[model samples]
Target: MTATVAATKAYDISGNVLKEDLRDIIYDISPMDTIFMTRAGRGTAKSTTHEWLTDTLAAVNAKNAAIEGDAFGAVARTLPSRLKNYTQIARKDFEVTGTAQKTSNAGMRELMAYHTAQASKEIKRDMEAGLLSDEPASAGTSVSARVAAGAEAWIYAPNHISVNQSAATTTAPVSGFATSPVTDGTATAFTSAGLNSMLQQAWSMGGEVDTILVGPTLYNTISAFTGIATRFRDVGSRQQAQIIGAADVYVSAFGSHNIVLSRWARATTVFCLDMSTWEVAYLRPFQTVDIAKVGDAERKALLAEYTLVAKSPMANTKATSMS
Candidate 1:
């Protein structure tokens, strides 16, 4: 190909006037689902140290019959055991320069506004992970931050099951509000046997297990289990056929459980929970506030102070050491 002699070309010109072809929307693929947080109940906490009480009735005795017309005798009444957890503060903040705030952006009008929205989602993800973690509770000092025990910490004794751990044993927290699983042992595949055993234990303790939370790897393994309830979906003749490959609800001798995939759940653990027995106690609800300007920049913070409440630890179970 040949061009005309001394012809002006677009590339030959400098500082050409042309509009940029930038999209108006921003695409973010980060996950934002908070399964545990959304499913758990909500409550209010008045102090940094949130407290709750749990009581149990006396075990059934076949010889509980008393002699007819016997004189009444005073018996000591059992009192509830108190449990407490420290409230933790989670926060996310961002700052925008004065010039950046005033400058035009491709996808958003103001940078600060977009960052504030992002902070909210980030904090939520953090809370979800924390609530499901094995971190122990701590009554922090001025230098250290307080920490609330998580669901894994509350599960103990009969409710806690060890999978393929080296010692075939799991440690329980000293108290419902302090300490955590001392060891994770070894990792292995999640099995139906482990799951059923935990469910049975929880049921024996009067737990009404209704939900099962698992990570991605375990989620897929659970779907392949033979025990999953059979699912049949009705389809119209004209409509395309649908393939059902995943298991959403698992039915066992104990009860039917809703199987949920958690993006932030621990890879080696699964939680069998009675939603009614769990709560998120908030001393201070989520709030956004503007920080005082230091220079020619605007600052903002997203803050929340909350604690995990295991209303009835016996009503929940944890399966650990699953790779």
Candidate 2:
């Protein structure tokens, strides 16, 4: 066979081509805002043992007496109706593996993505869960014990008037209710009268329930509610189409409330919130700490030492049993 001239071959590395569109696409789109909680209040806890007193019960009475007849009569001193505690710590941690720390650069923070914004999201998500749940925390070995008097555990304590799913069952109060608390089952569909009654009851007791929070299921149910006023702009052009089916406001005889659909809220419950009486009492505001080096990995953690403060459980009402 005749010898041939030297042949040339090509390799992928020969070309200086740009990398495939490594566009970091993040799809985490759950509502992570502490909207209802923030609307309630914000404060700094003086110490790990944060305490606040709810105002005395509404007991003003009209009495018939001469101008000076009972002016000197002894009246009982009005003490704080209920005492509450803000003594819970919520925290999370984020660690970067040594390899990831040195070889990751897809998102904004590169290796610190999880440490910064993602870590914040993690903490915020948990806060939302605590804000919307009826969970009770029994101080862990690492965490402080919940104050036993009242407002012991989480933000949405079981103290609120929780209309149970079982209509026959009743929810007893941890302490005397601010007034006659709402106690009604919601295992079925929501009704205009039912909602109106709850609103009226709360309003009568001096609570301004200006917000109604619901889960996706109830959101759809509310959107379909006949009582919800539907407002739309007329698009005269036949070719133009408009989308509807959003419930932004609900006007009742008692008061008008802003309706909000929450992703993290419980599907079986709806909250009639008086945002003015809620608070996020921070023992230690959200901050990141750099851990001491224990391995080749770079370690960081997001920390938030805080607790929910429900000034008065009576100020809020919840409808449970929603299936």
Q: By TM-score, who's the top model here?
A: 1
lDDT of 2: 0.63
Cα lDDT tens digits for candidate 1, 281-321: 99999999899999999999999999999988888888777
RMSD after CA superposition, every candidate: 2.0, 5.8
lDDT for each residue of candidate 2 in 8-106, tens digit (9 for 90 to 100): 434443465545667775666656666665575888887655567767564666774478554576777778755444356666666777787778576
Q: Model 1, 185: alpha-carbon shift in Å?
A: 2.3
RMSD of 2: 5.8
Model 2 misplaced regions, further than 4 Å: 1-21, 24-31, 57-63, 67-71, 97-99, 142-186, 233-241
Checking candidate 1 for backbone clashes, the offending pairs are: 188-323
Q: Residue 110 in candidate 2 has what lDDT?
A: 66
